[model samples]
Target chain A: MTEPLATGSTIGILGGGQLGRMLSVAAARLGFRTHIFEPGANPPAGDVAHAVTTAPYEDEAALRAFANACDVVTFEFENVPTAALDLIEAQVAIRPGREALRISQDRLTEKKFLESLGLQVAPFADVPDMDAMTAAVEQIGAPAILKTRRFGYDGKGQARLHKAEDAQTAFADMNGAPAILEGFVDFSHEVSVIAARSPAGDVACFDPGENVHRDGILHTTTVPARLNTSQRMDAVLMAGKILNSLDYVGVLGVELFVTSEGLVVNEIAPRVHNSGHWTQNGCTVDQFEQHIRAIVGWPLGDGSRHTDVVMENLIGADMDRVPEYANDKDVALHLYGKTETKPGRKMGHINRIVR
Target chain B: MTEPLATGSTIGILGGGQLGRMLSVAAARLGFRTHIFEPGANPPAGDVAHAVTTAPYEDEAALRAFANACDVVTFEFENVPTAALDLIEAQVAIRPGREALRISQDRLTEKKFLESLGLQVAPFADVPDMDAMTAAVEQIGAPAILKTRRFGYDGKGQARLHKAEDAQTAFADMNGAPAILEGFVDFSHEVSVIAARSPAGDVACFDPGENVHRDGILHTTTVPARLNTSQRMDAVLMAGKILNSLDYVGVLGVELFVTSEGLVVNEIAPRVHNSGHWTQNGCTVDQFEQHIRAIVGWPLGDGSRHTDVVMENLIGADMDRVPEYANDKDVALHLYGKTETKPGRKMGHINRIVR
Candidate 1:
């Protein structure tokens, strides 16, 4: 934005899921308006958004109107089609910039970008076809995971190559899509840093949170993660390096594999991440607001941890425990207003202060 | 409210000011939708609410439609017309109940109700007319304040009787309105306890916050008020007594005057009060969510304080310092999204965590 978005300025959010819902609330807190653009009917974010346009990204007319209405545009979905962004970017600035999105959209490009930054990353080789898969397995060995280069989330579009003999099967699972074989790196645990950088180059990172995965989906993230002083610094420094390198101007979630060697970059999300949800209860300015502040060119709030927090995602059936959790002291619930409780769907989350 | 309002159920709010705006955001956080029934065009709450009914309370059709659309209804503005409420209450549950609203709507009734509960309120007597004013001043003595029995707030509709001779002028200031005489009490400072009660009779109270007012408007509220343990206990007990007496099923704010003799009941606000704004940063579940939980039959989230906080109201010109406050660490800004900065109008507030 040429200037910090003034109070009542509209912020256009790309997707209308939980993140957009929260970003909308945070925008209201900061005196800004939010307009959600999503092709879905009755999007969760629409409940809180000032305006919502139910039109596909391909609709240039809708994109133009949305772009014109917004002071600045940002996204919850990283895989927004390049053509849609091209249309919107022509009218309004898209925060985190196209470079961050371009690099993070494809796993292969993201790995190469992180590797080029002299960052520690999992061993990987691009597998264009079955022929390349053979070479990738020959180099990366067994127990590697074959993942599609794009549109992969929550363990989707991925297959495990448990042994050298499983390469063909894993390759077949890709369905002729461009894939990458990631070599296994044994790690004690996983952690993520949620950080924000203003357009003015000021950066702020919330304390890293230790994460646990259940069925390949994020189950819980506890703040004040068990990391030595050096490990914590390494994690934060790595986040700053990536943010600065990408000229990022919004919240970015960097997942790290805490290995014996050092912190390895597992992946990065260009928008607010579920792992940062604990900040809602643990910090004065949570990750959602921090992202709004950054994208608007306002100084980032101090997201430094105040209290230890454990954020647990309520996926599908986990939502049934809401009443039980509501009775728990020091627990703050952040549920998305979704009508259905489909399995594997993100229902909501709770941030429990670990007193 | 027969049972906990299921996710996606709409909660109708009676006002669309800053408090209603915050309440809407809180409701959305809990997976609930909000419909704001506000007469004003483009109210602040409309920015975050799922629906906005722009119709006056006198419009029975609008009230009926709004009531039919909501599962439960509550208010941010306490002075909602009783006629309008009677129409809507027939269709939906209005939380905190009509009893709380009835007593609080009038200064005389509220004070007498407190006095009947054995609460130490300021010395007062009815002054329904100029003829009655003389007897009231005589019984209550000089140096008292003449206030309208109904529709008074923020030091409005009040005149000070500094001496016995000032009674006629003070009484005349009432403009033939039903008035009450309040004998001034010796006090050091003011404080308030934000408390909540559920239909099941569960009561929870946040710590008393010492309030400082300027020009008859709340300026700041500092948590961990300098109150003795006995004083704190008395405040909480007083709140519980008031809540139970009226069958109040939502958050209530009880303002008190700390005197050498004891804590005196200054006044009570049946809805969320500005003094409780600090709870947004100091407690796990803030007053807005607590109020929502209570009205919806959901268990009240624990509101016990976790951090020391000082909430300062940004009224009128105070909004100019927003950028400064934004750069300050540990300060959480809650701007109202008001388009204009009118003198004496509350723009927003800041919760500064006093670490």
Candidate 2:
């Protein structure tokens, strides 16, 4: 096993959004410093991180300097530029490794990966051109989602086709990029399993959190998800299988569709997930700390849920309710240090412990 | 009631130690920024705070800039220079107010304040010189302790007089500083009440925590202390009385000696206390967040403990055991990010939840 990082060692994080900001705070709590490398100026993580490199990913000198300053590197988002990772990986160790990132960065690859593991996934077909898109529509059927193979998030880079007649328009919406046509699964509900894997191959998963979405954005995630004993075990076992298959180290967020037949894998996020925010209030150690521990080669913390929690995202104007939450006795508010509250932007979240 | 601080307002902290570090993290979670003004270079809080002014308190220009940048000012340590406070108070509001600081900064004033409130305190006599020391011994009797009136902590600036013959040496040990002689209170154990008071006069107190000290320094603090329901209620009521009497607007740690007659007030710290660290794991809002909420004029959070936790300090060489603790599933480790760990210096702490 790789040696654990010593106290005071710096961890290089490749994104400066809310995820990175929370990760920096957790790293600080564990006596480690975070050096954030983000192209955006005055990023939120810069407010809490020990250092920040405000240069584009293509800036080789900047990447070299950041890598040299850190003992290990980790990314807050799976879509981090490959050129940047190649430079950083050559200089320092990157936790969760490149394989996990490669598989999750593309929709077609991720779906195939799950299928290879004997995990159920939505019926999908690769559509590289108009002809392929037509064939995919015939195979995958209607009521499908046409998503760009790479760089899609928060409902962006996606088009829905209600029937075979809409396939041509949906393919045009892809803007000539490679796409994947996935048939919609008639699932009862969606749930996410936040799992962590240490360098020593120890895997631990938090209880599944039932999720609700609005306008293609996550609205709320409630713990003690409507899952029976067998379903919970199934989720945990599948998450462990994925971690071991990829030889992954760090926290991974596995989104699943709870269908009548069983659990179907939707996607995986190879970093701290928003659905896991309830762990901050419901468990002894939150997912942020678990991610840090995994990257640093420390033992994974217990992921047992001790209380029932419902985490609601405060998107944009939802921040108007801050006063009410501030007066709440059971609510734990976490606001990202964003200067602007643009429409649809995530401003913060509230984890209210009901029990 | 004073106006609550706006979401993006910056809170200025006087000392950038571990308390300030934790406070900065809490402030960030609440969507507030923190500017840390620390005389010492490379303070731990600097890593997490939005801004750090590394100038001595005597630097008028630095002090002015810091005060102008903040919406309100609060301190982690009680012994802040009065002159610095005078300047800052002129620019921004300082919570817990001057009265609380003035009373707690001096041993004699704090003891007298408690006595005036009808709270029990050890019999104490003022000792300014040789003659007064002799008279104090006669009044307070032997088997007493002589302590400097100001700037004493962790058993420093204290001398024990076991008998009348030992009084002379003990008096000479005062080093010309004004002192107070207190007859020791024979107690069962020591407990501390962490209480908070908001600007609107709302008061809340966490359950008393039993404390264990080694070398006159706090070693561990365990929640759900060994106290009957009546004793617990008595402690909370007295804490509320003190907060109301002072018209306090922040967290206060009240140390008490549980004697057979009643609970004797040992001293009061008008800021977040070390013995309250267990709240980080056991409460929805920890002492640091409670202090920030009180200072910012917001409604206080719930101080109820949901789990039993034992907070053990990792001082100096104790950090060597960090690896072991890191491997423990139930242990929540907090490291101060101190570069050097000298003897008796608090490096970090571990909050291990038993249940």
Candidate 3:
């Protein structure tokens, strides 16, 4: 077998948002260099990385240069343009390969993939056209959500059809973009399982985190999620099944709906997830470091929890409450260093570790 | 009050060693830019910093350019030439001011300063010449250690004169460099208290870590040291007295000897220290971040421990055990991206957090 990249090797990151920023920090801790390829004038990750490429993703020459400079390329977000991945994959290795991204990009395909693996997922129907939209409404009923098959996040590009009029108008508002209509599941609470798998097929999973949402965004995640041993094990099993199916080489965050019947898979994030922030304080190796290890072909760390932890997100105006947490004996405050605190923005987080 | 430096403000560091490397990573988490200024070609800190200046310490033009670019300045080592500090101090703000450095640079002055603050210190006297050395030996005894007042570290520039025949020869070997004769305290153990003080006079101290030295170099530090509550309290109080007296604005590491009678201050490091490595995995905020907060004028964080921790240094050839650690559970490994590892060099450290 080829020798694994040494600690001083460079890791190329496709995006330079907060997730990339955090991952870059993790790579540096392991004595790995990070080179950021981002289109933005200023990327948070670039502020600390060894090198940065500011050209657009369409700049194939710059993409080649970035790939040539790195040992392996990994992305922060899965919605990265397919062409961008193909360019880097041709020039260098890309972890959590393109197949995983293609499946996760489309809502219908992701749901179907879960079904194929014998996992219970929320019932979803494809809306091919206006007629399909009407048929889906009839089949799924009111109070269901219609979402675009691709490029949607943070409550964007999705509509809740609570009434008959809402269905047709909402469908037209989407301008007939290919979409999926999901029937609402009666979930008592939402939880997520963060699992990592190394190239050698070694798998490690963190304790499931019970998540609370605000305005369709995660607000807090409490570890040792209020679930029985069986339920927790079920959540982790679903994540491992997904990772193995995808041949995943990094951390995957699997969101689940805890229904009266059993656990139902909601979605899979190919990288670190907001709900897994509790791992930063509760677990031995956090999701950030685990992601680094997986991408760098290193052994996966123990993802077990030593302390019960509650992670509260500092959204927008809530950032002002950071000072109150500073003096709280159990609280660990983390500010994201964002310049503006617009409404609905993630400003920071505070994790409290309970012994 | 003046406005706190903004998130994007640049912090110029005076040394590019491992401490500066870790400090750069910490500053990046807060969205502050870091510029490492050192007189080396490829320092470890350069791997992650926004910018680096490779020029001799006496290069005034380069020093001016670096100071002009940064909003604030801090040093990773006390051995930074006073001329460099003078150049930067004239152009920008320097935290943990010059007086703190002057006191810490000399063992004699540091001991005197510690004793003046009503803190327990090992008996020490200055040996200015052969006559003074004879008198010092008569008073402090033959088993004492004679150390250069300046530029001594990792057991360098110091000699243990165990026999009367070794005293004059060891004293003459110092070449008349100012020296301090310290009466060795036959202590049960060595420990350290890492503390931070904000400009607002707020102080926060991490729990004392019991330390063990191999060949006068720190090999391991265990947190929640085997000390009573009163002993822990005394350690914190002594650190507080030193910081408040110096009006220190960053993290300081105070090494102590736990004697049968009480705690005696061994040495004071006016910067982030090796003994505080456990804080990276044990406490909510690591010592590097604590130093950044104090220097940037932010309030101190909760210094509470989350888990009992053991930090083991990977000195020189011990880095070969990295793969062993990578496969271990619950250990956070950090390796400096240094190109070479000579004997007695600090390559990195691993922190294991145990419940």
Candidate 4:
């Protein structure tokens, strides 16, 4: 048998957001070196990685160099271009490979893929134009969301259709981009299950966390999410189905809307998620490290939550209150080193472990 | 009052070891950047810092530039030169300042300082020469340790005196350096208290961890150290006293020997210590982050452990077992990413949390 990826191996990470930043920190903790590849100046991951490549995604030469430097490659965000993946995969093994990214990057494609797995997703229909948008509204009805098939995150590239006239306006604003109309489910609450699957087929998952959102951005995620045993099991089963189907390795966050009928998969982020931040303080192994171990081909760690944890996002100006939060003796303030904190920017987060 | 240190402020760190590496990671989490000043290539902290100055301590021009680039400076090891500290202090604020370093770098001075604080230390006498060594052996008897006053760690620069006749040989072997002969304390155990004190006089300490050593290198540290309530309280009090007396503003590690009578001061590490590694997985806020907050004049975080933890060091050959450890659940492995693994060198560590 081939030798397993050993200590001192370098892990290449795509994207340099806070997720990549935290992932680099976790990888370092596991005796693995991390090299970050991002197309920006002073990215958060740049501050913690062994090396960083600051060339644009189109720079095949730099991408090839980064891939050659690492034993295995993983991404922090799912929107990595297909060309970038192709360039890196030519030289280095990319975990949670192209199939996983292909399915997750598009709203319509992801929903269809989930349905193919016999998973329950919100009622969705593809809309190519204003006429189709109107037709989709008629089929999915009012209170549905029209989201671009590609490049949407934290509620961006989305528009809610409260009235029929809003559909045409939404379509025009979307620049006639391919879109999907998702029928809004009257959910009792929202929750996310973050799970990791190793190349060795070892799957470990943290407990589902209850989520609350502000302006479509996640506000707080509390563990022991108000779910019964069956609900909890359903979340885990859904996450596993997705990972197994995609032959995925590394962490995938599955957001679900808990309707009165049952749990409905809202979206699948093929990487670490904000809701999993609670694991940083509550679980024996945080989601970042779990993702690292999974991509590195190591057996997954114990994903058990050791404490009752509540994680709050310090969006934009909310980071100013870190000092006040630091005094509570109950909260762990974590600020992402982002220089400019504009409105809706995710600046940091605070994790509180309740006794 | 002056403006609080804002996000993006640079924190300069001296001595780029694992402690510095972890400290840089923590500082980045706070929206603060780190610049590491060390005299070698691939120093541990250099892997994560925003900037690194690889120059000797005597490179005053480079030192000034590093200090100018940082808002404040701190260190990860106590043995950094006094002149180095002087150069940085002349240009910027150095937390846990020069006085703390002066007392901690030299065993004789540290012992005397502890004694002056009305804290109990092992009985000791300064050894200026072979005659003084003989006199110290006569007073303290056999089974004592003859240690050089400075630049000793992991049992280096120390020799044991098993008999009265060994004093002359031991002293000569130490090259007649300024030394101290310490009577070994008949201790029941060894424990360490890791505490952080901010400039505002706020002090917070994690629960003491009982330490076990092998070959004079730390092997394991367990939290909720098998100490009674009284002893735990004593450890906390002793650590706090040291922080307050030194006007220290950073994390301080106080190693104490639990003797038949009570806890006796062993040696203090002015920065994060190996024994505190368990806090990364066990506590809401770890010693590294706490140190970052303190030195930046930010409020201190909670130093409470949420679970019982055991931290094992990955010294030299032990690093080879990292793959096996990575596959194990409940283990949080941390490697320094050092290129070389020389015999007896500290490569990394792993913390296992047992609830």
TM-score of every candidate: 0.99, 0.99, 0.96, 0.97
Chain A TM-scores in order:
0.99, 0.99, 0.97, 0.98
Tens digit of per-residue lDDT, candidate 4, span A146-165: 89999999999998888777
Complex DockQ per candidate? 0.85, 0.82, 0.61, 0.74
RMSD after Cα superposition, model 4:
1.6
Give the better candidate number (2 or 3) by TM-score. 2
Off by over 4 Å in 3: A1-3, B1-6
lDDT of 1 by residue, B1-355 (tens): 5788887899999999999999998999999999999999989999999999999999999999999999999999679999999999899899989999999999999998999999999999999888899999889998899999999888899999989999899988999999899999999999999999988999999999999999989999999998999999999999999999998899999999999999999999999989999999998899999999998888998888889999999999998999898889879999999998999999999999898
Q: Which lDDT tens digits does candidate 3 get at residues A1-355?
A: 1355788899999988778888888888888889998898677787678888998889999999999999999988888888888888998888877888899999899999999999999888998788888889888887889999999887788999997568888787677689999999999999999999989888899999999988988988998788888898898888999999888999999999998899999999888888888887777788999999998888999888877899998888886775566557687766666677788888778888776
Docking quality class, candidate 1: high
Interface RMSD of each: 1.0, 0.8, 2.0, 1.5
Which ranges of candidate 2 are over 4 A from the true structure? none
Candidates' C-alpha lDDT: 0.93, 0.94, 0.87, 0.88
Per-residue lDDT tens digits of candidate 3, residues B77-168? 99999898999899998998899999999898888888888888888889889889988988888788999999999999998999756788
Count clashing residue pairs per candidate: 0, 0, 0, 2
Query: Candidate 4: misplaced stretches above 4 Å?
Result: A1-3, B1-3
lDDT (10s digit) by residue, model 2, range B165-240: 8988998898999999999999999999999999899999988999999998999999889888888988999999
Segments in model 1 whose C-alpha atoms lie over 4 Å from true places: none
Q: Cα lDDT for residue B333, model 1?
A: 95
